[model samples]
Target chain A: MSTAMGNPTAGASPGASPGASLAGDPYAPQQDTVAGPVFTVTGQDWDAVVAGAAEAEDERVVVNMGPQHPSTHGVLRLILELDGETVTEARCGIGYLHTGIEKNMEFRTWTQGTTFCTRMDYLAPFSYEAAYSQAVERLLDIEGDIPQRAQDMRVLLLELNRISSHLVAIATGGMEIGALTVMTIGFRERELVLDLFELITGLRMNHAFIRPGGVAQDMPPGALEQIREFIKLMKKRLPEYAAFCNANPIFKGRLVGVGHLDLAGCLALGTTGPALRSTGYPWDLRRTQPYWGYDTYDFDVVTWDSCDAYGRFRIRLEEMWQSLRIVEQCADRLGNSEGDPVIVADKKIAWPAQLAVGSDGMGNSLDHIRHIMGESMEALIHHFKLVTEGFRVPPGQAYAAVESPRGELACHAVSDGGTKPFRAHFRDPSFVNLQATSILSEGGMVADVIVAIASIDPVMGGVDR
Target chain B: MTDPDARTDDDKLRAGSRGEAAGTAKQEPKVGSTPQGAERDLGVQEEMPENTVVPAGADSLEVIAVREGMFGVQGSGDTSGYGGLRRPVVMPGASPRPYGGWFDEVADRLADGLGADAQAAVEKVVVHRGEMTIHLRREHLVTTAQHLRDDTGLRFEVCSSVSGVHYPEDTGRELHAAYHLLSMTHNRRIRLEVSVPDSDPHIPSVVAVYPTADWHEREAFDFFGIVFDGHPSLTRILMPDDWPGHPQRKDYPLGGIPVEYKGATIPPPDTRRTYG
Candidate 1:
């Protein structure tokens, strides 16, 4: 490696003048004859010089990992410089899934932006909506008076989103490493969760149900029953999922010691969620920086100290069970608040009457309209104004962060004192968590890179949005 | 489990006179953004055509009508008459950076430990909104990045995100790339923004300092037409190489051909269309 040092420009200090080295070299003794009495170089000194020479060697080979390859989880390309299979350097390339959602939000109304944001992190749409809505509501300063029932409903929905997101992580992580059976079981459980969401919001994915002021509407009748059934179903399957994947020798071999990231690397790479938690850091936003009534919830923050891929797997599996516990508690709370209004009574922020198509192809009954219009002029005018024009938000900026299944999902919203936000930026967990990939992939087999990425479990929509 | 009754209601609504009348009438405007004071003064009845005459205390309803793009009014109005509009305020110091000299203070603090290479590399520091971004010279980019990570007071440590933006029409700096850096101990974030001329849009790569920047720099190179000098593999991640201009630029016309959705012809942005 030191052969390159023969060039007069070699090992020169960044700021040193070119003339200074030449002046010093010619004046010095030919072989340092005055320093030692013709002493031969020792084996230790030779080894030290050789090691120093090797440090300056530029022998690493560059390899492109993917833009279309599997194990990337998405359209992620990694440029790795390697000495054999060991990576000397790594670079991650992303933005294949960029859809300009932030710029798109600038053109949309405050309420309409929720619909676009929900599609950002596909696996955890509700969590995305919740963070966006919470920011908008905070800017409006009307979130304080939000109905208790609406708050409870949001908690219930977010917890379910957490479980569904983790299921994807577990299933996909297992599948990426050749554990095909875990994928089937994971999807089967996730389908039940999606079914519950479909019953409430009329869509399985991208359910823009949670809005700025409250949910899109009250839970459909028997939605809680479906949720209860889902909880029971997930509870019974949890053990089977663990037994089929977690306890299997093949699964353990592939995951247990692969992609180990120490706590310092995790922090330096800005990793959060399970990636950070698995590294012995107890930094869950739900516990440390509570939002969306998370402070009121009673649950334990699950953590692991192994800081390896298996630790992440264990943490997520345990987190799913904890989410189920929260869901059951939320269902109990919902039963008590059945008759209470789900949205805040403020007409500016909420729809006048919950509009649903009836048997007669009309939004509301004639009698209902008659009672509202003829009997109460204020109600009639309020309904008309709200239906025609939405509420205006005060111009200011507010940020709201939620403990998403991936990590801290935050929305930074700026209103130009208008009905629409001037700018909306999402601090997506996937974007932050994906930073750890290069660090985890280095010094590991190329196959382990797949497991490391799966453990991170980034939703490309969220990462690229 | 499908309901036949639901289908009959949908058919009736489709066939009803109410639907025909509603379709023929002027379509309702998109909600939000009417001056609140003027809207409240117009009162509730003013929305109806029969009650077009101004009501009592309606002097504040000054309607300045727009003629192009989307037609709308922009003036003071009441909440009810104009759908909860609020007056727009010209906030003081609402430029890109609102925090004034604070960015310079932060940048000066960085000058000491970053060494002369980093100091020479950093050209301008601007504070936009609450975010501070230090613009750097392309040649000294790697040195600056290393200082940001290793320096004690400015231990950015992590490169949280990197993205690119295009301003093709803008002179001097047409290709803008931004790097978001975070210090976990400080729990603070700083942005490193660089701009290169469109003619030769190449900046030094930070991949050596933070490996995560490799993908981000390549993406910038791909979408915004910028290039990273030392990037290992810089190629298009989303669009094909034969693709014309950077799509994200504000001036780049969003056009490709019409997309037919549910029998509705949705023309490209550049197409001329007459909406019924």
Candidate 2:
């Protein structure tokens, strides 16, 4: 730090003379007033502080906060220009986690694209997978042929993913602002949701189950019961969080009126999901566009007029409840839809791998292996052709979007009559929402930048991808 | 920029417009009724949309020689049997109206707004499967995007994405930039595409019209080497500051490593011998 102004007595001790101003009046005795010094100056350090106060410039200082910062949620670097404690300008630097997913997708088969897309927003993998699969389906012109059962299952898993995602958002948002108890509470609830995800999808995260044809397989036995149990647990637990953080003055103070972005700002920045809804606009694609038969499900698009960090947090909390309500409806629908096919009848696009749980965990079913290896040559050829080259989507392009936990996570797919994608780019909400950070954080205290970023909830994996 | 007189592309386009600007001048009444230019299929058998290619003789269109491999890989990497599948590089031709659904409405309205200039500015209008794509000349991208966003009838307020698609097979025009636009007022989405040659990838930046296109344009530049000419601070968005070649472009090598499992080692997918 340039502490030249920190010491006033460097020129005032013994034979030392006071600088120019004191030179004008030798005996005038300088108090060196800078507003009012917060503390009394007596020691050498104190004298140095007062001495250096005269040398201090009102110029701005630039602070580079992490690409490795814990509060940034991922490898996001923020360059902030500060005038004292207040930030004058803020710019976000991303790409620390660019995995080159779009490039990789060009090399993989159409079905393998889901595995890559799911990893973009690791928090809400279902949304990415669904968007990519839907885009391919749109290219195939079989969007209407997807089974009703699969559609319900998609909504079910997506809502579950949203709940788990929002839990992490609130948990991390709370922890960043020093709510340790909430961090524990949030993760604990998230574990339950993840456990349910594991029960149904085989793996908790990066479930490539949602494919071009339909879901990988039907829901396992009694997975709905576990979801029902989670819903019950969350119903009792959500109000407790409300009682804890919502009532805590420190929490409310740090959130409300802090990192405020009104409706116009949200629109200008193209921030959606909770951030936009926080501004009181009900633009949830689930409700507005109603993909995946979301219209059949019963749930309200939650909104809060606060338009600040508190509002973003509040909307996440309520969105989880709405997710729970939707999950409940999906569970009820699962009863009538049990015998229905998950993957569509189009055998060409459908993954025929009879997945089974062996001692080594999930793998291709032994019976399916025997059947394919020993049965008709046509089955073997069909299986080999589908698995290796995958099905070709006629040359075209389509953009598919879904309301992810953060915002509108969209995938734009271009097909050139090839098994692999010609180009697949996901318009990750985290990347878009993060643009508002500079606007929301500037002119606010330096610490509020963390709150602003937390409210924006950018996953650098998604942002960089 | 909207003045039809100053930015005419060719004598043919200029001749087509005539005196359409009668201060609200009499535009070509049927406004580019038939596509006047030739677009060759480059001899690669176009499996889909075969009936759509205009019967004009394939000449003057430079054909790119297809190398052996899936994508552009040189070796055995044909894990998927799609190798040697010659997907003919076909630039979509103009669709005849009733262009179907709300697409016609958007297209007709855009033509009326741009008047005679629409024929020159918009190179082609393609409706594939369900979505509509208006292929604009790269130079007119910014003006067209602004009109799409501000026009009361079109009100495509949201510029959803600005992504680059690289097709090395499409000679001359190898890099195509597509903008996904959302009209919130109309609850519709339309794609705007601009094709530029890989030799000179100069598509005008739409950041002034849709601020959301700012970082997206930078990302397109980073991944596909498409230059958004007027973008503000058009620096790399997703790649490292000093990263060399845009990785997403066709012919960019798939840098892969061999996979080792148990005792056996399998060559990288690109190097694996394929049915092709």
Candidate 3:
């Protein structure tokens, strides 16, 4: 393995300057290093050869592990300085997936901004949609006036998103560490949550369901039934994670002490979600600073004292139970508020058309279509204006934050009193948490580097956005 | 499920009259700014005309530019006859004393923490829409941030976000960098803003006080071209290093190339029939 790690520098063309660019060809061997010692030991004398190689203390290897490597979890590049098996220094090269979403949002209207941000963190699209919508609502000064049913529905989506996002984190983490069974079960449970999302919002991922004033539409019939069934199924399936990996000797060996970060380190790095909760801080924004009426929901803030990969895993597992508790409460509230308005009462901001599922697909309800087409020329004009121009937000800035499955996801939305936003910036947790790469991976073995990053669990979409 | 039969003919006639009034009113764009003290009436009315509210208090607004067309259109492309729309671009001004809520307390604590240099360090405090912002001079940003974090009364342990905005019309202070700080201990949030001229757009990095600002400051620098003077390795983060212009600036073009299919060329989104 070390011989393969050592040959790239020798393969560089003669006289190429050290650290010169590969000229946009990613597959080309980096010619930055002088040739180093390489060894091959095939016999029982391997011990003697290893001892001799260990004596060459000045031999250091620079390894670039990603931007394409699978274990790095989505285009995360780790530049590592290794001495033997131990990492001496670690640095991160990111932004491989930058799509300029923030800049694109400036041209679209306030309501259209949700569609762009929902794509930022694809695994937790509802969190981005909710945060951005909350910011827009605050700028409009209608935070307190959001309908109770809408708030309850938002809580339901957010909690379900928490379960789904954490499942991906655990599944991918387990897969990276060679535990394929955990990966399969994690995804299996996640699909159930996605099923509920599909039923409620029509699309499984990047639904763009949550809007500035409220959700795109009211809950479809039978959504509550599926949610209740989901809660019941999760109650039984939740224990399997604890049973399978909680006490398994190998899982503990791989995770118990790897990627250890205490409360102080987490705060300094601005880490949140399970990574921070694992330090036993109980600093979840849902509890510490609630939004979307999360304060009204009854649940415990899950935490573990170990401050390591294993503790983060346990926090995610336990937090799913807590999320189920919130989801059930949201389902109950949704059931009671059956006929209430989901969008705001204001005609200027509320979407003009009422939506209903048709034989073809979702579209404006026939009743609404008839009222506009036949009865009211006024309503038709209003619909055309609102649909094409979108709603204008009063000029100002507001920062709205929600505790996402990842961390403190915030949207700092600024408006110039126009239909479009002047500026909209997201404080995505993946972007902030990835800064801890060096602090977490340095001084650890090469294998543990993967464990450390998997613990961070950054989705490159959110990180690069 | 509102009762469709509940709408009386009289009510429908009244609603129809109001809609026609609005349609005629929209054609002749509303002139003048929103009435002063309108901020006090937020969320009080169920229905409001678009662009009637200035989100901040009247005392804290200064009109920077007068927009001449509706939907932000310029030149001769607008044919909706709403091109007569005229509105002022109101930039938030310095707020007066007795700022409401915990904002006043935070401002006082931040000033006391800065001690002798508080007068020069903090340019002004603006409290708008239940959020507090302390405008700090670029030179004193780090010290002000240190005091904000370490001071007992204001232990803003987390630097939540750093964003940059470019106002080309703001002349000497064309570029603004805003930092959102969260005090987990006190359960309060505050923002610190610093502005520099576009000619010399530099603000001292606060990574020393809040290590988490590392990538955020880089992002601000990459998008808005605001230079963070002491950032460890201030390089483009979200955009490629070879990329030419800061894409988020107001002056930057939203670029897209035309596409041709079946011998017909289609213009890009920005060049299409833009509403804004």
Candidate 4:
């Protein structure tokens, strides 16, 4: 940390407005081109822009692309200073969909925190759910108590979510660059993945089925067969995605040399996942620091040396194939472990809901009710106690990080020996990785900004959450 | 425990491989500024011993523990369903030496790297569960973090995350900033924590050392109002620019409006009855 080095705003000045990078003035001198003029309204950066303009003078305008454009990839706003068509500088403005998820977690119980986390990175909700659940499980000091079947299911679901999420990245990244054909094909594959999710967890999205003690329940009958079918279907579709984008000149040209962020920039900006892997560093948390039995899974950590949008796009394409291999292994494990409890052995932390879908809907199993009401008073009391006042977590904090589709999606759970979370701060990879857009997009053509951001694949729900 | 042991064996083998790879990586043409800890600390403390082995374990000391109430309220909320639950949450005292696997190795490395100021810089070393946390004085955060990064034996190059936790009950220093650092080279992880009193909530930012901390510091400022002394731009990130208060502070309300449905009203959970 540098000290206040004479410049009032350089180091630590309390009043330094962070948004000033994109804080252009609404009433600055304007130069008209397409998308309006570069308004020097931010007032301070004007002189610097003006001074730099003398060296490479043209009509250098500041273009505010989006807090709400279709192609900006979720409500990300880019403030780009264009010298003719080439962008001289860029800055990002985020937090359009701030729901205060971190603050809201304090009001909910430990088991309920999974529901909130899963919603952050919506594309790969299961991984976020796993990270939060794993943290709570660790906080209870019962990471070991979770069953082998439960851990296997977590890996299976997470890898499935990764394929679906990467499909979205390819689909959306293609759509951003006018490759609409690939988008249709990508989402078609995503539909198959989401179908498997619905079959396994009973929800297509935001599945809180991954519980603190273990998963909410065991896999539905023949759910493994559905995954096996999806894997076979996906293995066929994988080459189609590669063939569509890998050969198209328009797609390759927009990505190959454009929006280039070197390996050093990736680290400085905290870029990981595919974007980091594209820089030729196979630093996947699953391989470098394994969690949730990922170490046991067999898969090659895919990497690329190009370090551009093309490299990033290729990595996601290759990663899907790798995810399928992992899923295939999970299906094999599930076959041998039939009727194993998905929930932990301890009755305390595990949610004891019977979860039977009847005429009314999913609710307490009628058999569980009969057993409690007609058979045992102790069973009823235990059910009532666990549900009403959730289990207590020993006072402490633990940070859990998992490799999601975006990057290292992590959560810091603090418990003050209470049933509810004291405070849970999610270190969302989207929020951190979104910072790299400025470093990558600047000094490149204005059109490539979209190419860069789409490759990063940030979900504003995660960023703003 | 069984899983980690097997992973540990795997990690040692991987560490040996990574070490050989790094030796070759150093010879590659300079791409840009290297973020590796050892490379950055090149000449800072060259005189120190290459590596120092932590001696025998110091006998653990006993400190008086207190169960003080937060805001002077003993069991503030109503206690009904959870009344029987008793968990005396104690802030752990300083851990004794020979602190289990890899922890003592890290502490010894930090001591050798920092030299004479090691004792003063490191406020307390707590090894809880299987993880170790090095608590540092607020002013020494950056220097200590640099040492944690640069030391050859303890190269926690990647800072996994930085989170702010407000413990209203912990008097004097109630707000704590925790950093989770990862040593990909050695396949190990450790936590670093720096606490600042609510009266003066300031800790020097480590953005220069770990550029990834840039947005995270802004986020901590937005939610918890922790003033990072050397942060480049300390402004609101997640919150609206004009948002009034730090929302994550324990004193702040959960602020959810009651939901009105068809002929029914359910108050937000915070306003509902709760056990103390």
The B-chain TM-score of model 2 reads: 0.70
Measured over the true interface residues after superposition, the C-alpha RMSD of each candidate is: 8.4, 3.5, 1.7, 6.2
**Largest TM-score belongs to which candidate?**
3
Model 4: per-residue Cα lDDT over A1-465, one tens digit each: 001111222222221332245445453333332332233334355544443334332455566777767899988888777777788888888989898787887877777788887888789899888889878877777888889899999999999999999999999988988999999998999999889888888889989889898898788888988888888888888999888879888888899977677777876677778888888989999988788788899999999999888999899999999999999999999999998888887887776654777888665688888988999999888987787667777656678889999898888887666668987888788888888888888888888999989988999999998
Candidate 3 local lDDT, A99-172, one digit each (tens): 98888888777888888999998899999999999999988888888898889999999999999999999899
| C-alpha RMSD values across all candidates | 17.3, 9.5, 9.7, 13.9
> Model 3 Cα displacement at B25 (Å)?
35
**lDDT for each of the candidates?**
0.66, 0.76, 0.79, 0.75
Error of 1 at B98 (Å): 16
The ten-residue window of minimal lDDT in model 2 chain A covers: A1-10
The model with the greater TM-score, 3 or 4, is: 3
List residue ranges in candidate 2 displaced over 4 A. Answer: A1-56, B1-92, B273-276
Instruction: Give the i-RMS of model 2 in Å.
Output: 3.5
Q: Across residues B40-106, which tens digit of lDDT does each residue of candidate 1 receive?
A: 2223434542212221221111111111111143234323254222222211111222235545445
Taking the candidates in order, what DockQ does each have? 0.10, 0.29, 0.44, 0.22
Residue A356 alpha-carbon offset, candidate 1, angstroms:
3.0
DockQ of candidate 3 is: 0.44
User: Runs in model 4 with CA error above 4 Å?
Assistant: A1-57, B1-88, B260-264
Docking class of 1: incorrect
For candidate 2, write residues A1-465 as lDDT tens digits. 111222333233311322333445444333343332122222243454444444444434455677767787889888877677798888988888988888888878889999998888888899999999999998888899999999999999999999889989999998999998999999999899889888888888888989998998788888878888888888999997898888799998888888889877776667788999999988899988889898888899999998899998989998988998999999999988888989888888887764788878756798888888888688889998888878877656789999999988889998765677878999999998888887899999988998889998888878987
lDDT of 1: 0.66
